[model samples]
Target: MKRVVFAVPGSLDTPTGGYAYDRRIVAELRQLGWDVECLNVGEGFPSPDKATQSAARSLLLKVPDGQPIVVDGLALGVLPDVAGEVASRHPLLGLVHHPLALEWGLSAERADALHRSEQAALALAREVVVTSPATAKLVASDYGVPAERITVARPGSDPAPRSSGSRNEVPHLLSVGAVVPRKGFEVLVAALATLVELPWRLTIVGDLTRDPNEAARLQASISQHKLTGRIAALGAVPSKRLAGLYDEADLFVLASHFEGYGMAYAEALSHGLPVIGTTAGAIPDTVPQEAGLLVAPGDAGELAGALRRVIADAELRRRLSDAASAAARTLPTWQQSAAIFATALEKLA
Candidate 1:
């Protein structure tokens, strides 16, 4: 059997999108009869302490010489030493969900540092894989990677289960994403504040990160607006429970400033829920116009208008829900994603 090693910064338990991507890819590849090995290089990564670096070096030394390897670009971009160790001896492919430098909320200095590290990692890989065409262009134009050397392979969503009458009692607007500035939760809250008289609720799901200042600011805004009762924060829900949330929600909204590929939007569509997303990053690629609505980023008024329109018009909501279900069915499955990835690896090998 062909052997493949996937090097990632965190395990499946990590809640970030990049970690989710690595977990899905590795599982899918294993189902395809490939011998897959997962190596977790710890949390601090690319900037590991001296002891962590020593451990990572030892881990890399154990990878079978000349075997094909796939590196999570988000993790590898921070750890050039790991990339250097594997590139010369193996067929190394970098799977980049999105360039770390492009993430929102970073200071200029941090963004530049991430950009430099990403470029260096890309330079070391024999092939690069991105999730969307937009990302492909970013890699080619910004990172100087040749277009031909990069492959666009999208992530897949789980099939919507048979409805078990799991819908919610009240009309609810749901947003699923980490509590970070880039997610634009503040915008969603601002939008919700506009419809204070309406009989509806808004739920924001996902764990709050280490940034206390952002969390405090959001909490203060909610308190200031007196939206405490109408809005609920349910952090880090399990996968099974999340599906129930999607089913119960009347509309799934993502007001993110940017996304490489909007996984939550796709998942919402899979559950036959209409989506409201910003026209940033690859959101336009995933959320079709007929499936839901799109507004400018950080435009709270427009977002509120869109939300109201979707909530008030039952016929429009039904139409969008049907369209979203159809669109979701067209998305590639994880098995298909694995096949595409395997083909790319074979060609590079």
Candidate 2:
């Protein structure tokens, strides 16, 4: 039987985009009859200390010989020394959702350190699997990975019911992502503050606990903007509950600093909710122009203008919604993504 070890940084249940991608891909691969073993090499990844790094390396070293080992980017990028060792023993495939150094809120020195380490780690891999073409390009051009060695298997979006829209007299805006600096929820809050006179409410759904300080900071920002009364913050929610939120939203927006594939934008399109997001990373690749409006990252005034236009013009909303439904039909399914991923894995044989 064909089998591979998928070594992830932490629990498979982490409710972020990267983990969600890992979970779905693993399930699809198993459904396709691959013997996929998920090895949790311990936590505190993308920033593991000496003891944790030693322990993680030990766990990875214990994988049986001859099995292809697929390591999540979060763990793989920070473990160059271990990756070199792993490459000596097994076929090492690095799965990168995005390069770690580009993440928001990192200091210049820290980002540079992560960049150097990730480039070194990726160099030793037999294959690199990225979730988007943008990442594939970045890895090849910036990380020095050969273009031929990379595969782009973007996250799959499940078909969802078109949003029935808000029951309220005001439009309901929805944004989904962890309450981290990268998601730019603070930017969203600042943008929304200028549109209060325009009848609209924003609901943000993401993991608040992932970064408590960032979450608390967002709360303070919301309070500062006097938008606590207009905005709803729901920490991590179950998939079903999220689906329900999608069903009720009039528009979807996320002012993310960067994204590998912007799964939330893909999901919003799938729900036939017109999108408003920043033009950072792979967002433009994810949200079709006809289906959404995009603004410069961190530009609150630009974002506010886009939001106001979308909120005030019902005809524009209808047009974008129709286009969004069209775009949704073009999204790949988990089954198709799994098939592609399987083919990528087969090439390693």
Candidate 3:
């Protein structure tokens, strides 16, 4: 049987878009009749300390020689040395969501350091798998990876019932993602603060505990803007509850600074919800122009204007909602993405 070891950085069940993509794709790979073994390579990725680095390095070296190993970029990008050793002994494939250096809020020195290491690690991999064509192009142009060696396997969207939408006079807005600095939750808060005059409410769904500092800052923003009553932050909701929230919402919004593929945007379209997002990372690709209004990242004025336009104009919201459902039909399935991953593995083998 075809076999490979899938080394992920954290628990498969982590409540985030990247982890969700990892979890779904791994399951789909198993269903495709491949002997795919999953390994939790620890959580200290992209910035592992000495102990974590040593432990992860030792664990990977124990894999049988010549075995195919696909390492998630979270861990792989920071472990250039370990990746080099593994690539020499086995088929190494790097699954990159995005380059580590482009993440928001990084100092110049740290970003450059990550850039050098990731470039080295990606070079050692026999093949690379990315979540979006945009990411593939970025890797090739910036990291010096050959475009031909990279495969774009975007996250799949399961068929979901069209949102029933809100029954209240006030429009409901939903923004789903982990509470990290990269998500631009504070920007969203600031935008919403200006829209207090509009009849709209926001419900944020994400893991607040992931970044305590960001979470605390977000709360401060909420209180400072007097949005404590207008916006509800529900931390890391269950799938069923999240689905229900989506079903109840009229519009979906997230002011992310950057995204590898913006899986949440795709999921929102699948629910037939109009989107309010910033033009960052792969979001413009994930969210079609017809499906929603997009603003410049970190521009609260533009974001507020976009939110106001959608919230006040019921006809505009209806038009975008219709377009969202059409976009959802174009999304790939998890099985299809796994087939792409399997094909990449086969070609390298």
TM-score of each: 0.93, 0.99, 0.99
Q: For residues 86-121, could you state the per-residue lDDT of candidate 2 as single tens digits?
A: 999999999999999999999999999999999999
lDDT: which candidate is best? 2
What value of lDDT does candidate 2 attain over all alpha carbons? 0.93
Candidate 2 is scored at a TM of 0.99
lDDT of 3 at 136: 87
Where does model 2 exceed 4 Å of error? Answer: none
Note the residue pairs that clash in candidate 3: 206-236
How do all the candidates rank in terms of lDDT, highest first? Answer: 2, 3, 1
Instruction: In candidate 2, list every pair of residues with a backbone clash.
Output: none
Tens digits of per-residue lDDT for model 3, 45-124: 78888888888889899999999999999999999999999999999999999899988889999999999999999999
Off by over 4 Å in 3: none
Clashes of each: 2, 0, 1
Pairs with steric clashes in candidate 1: 46-78, 46-79
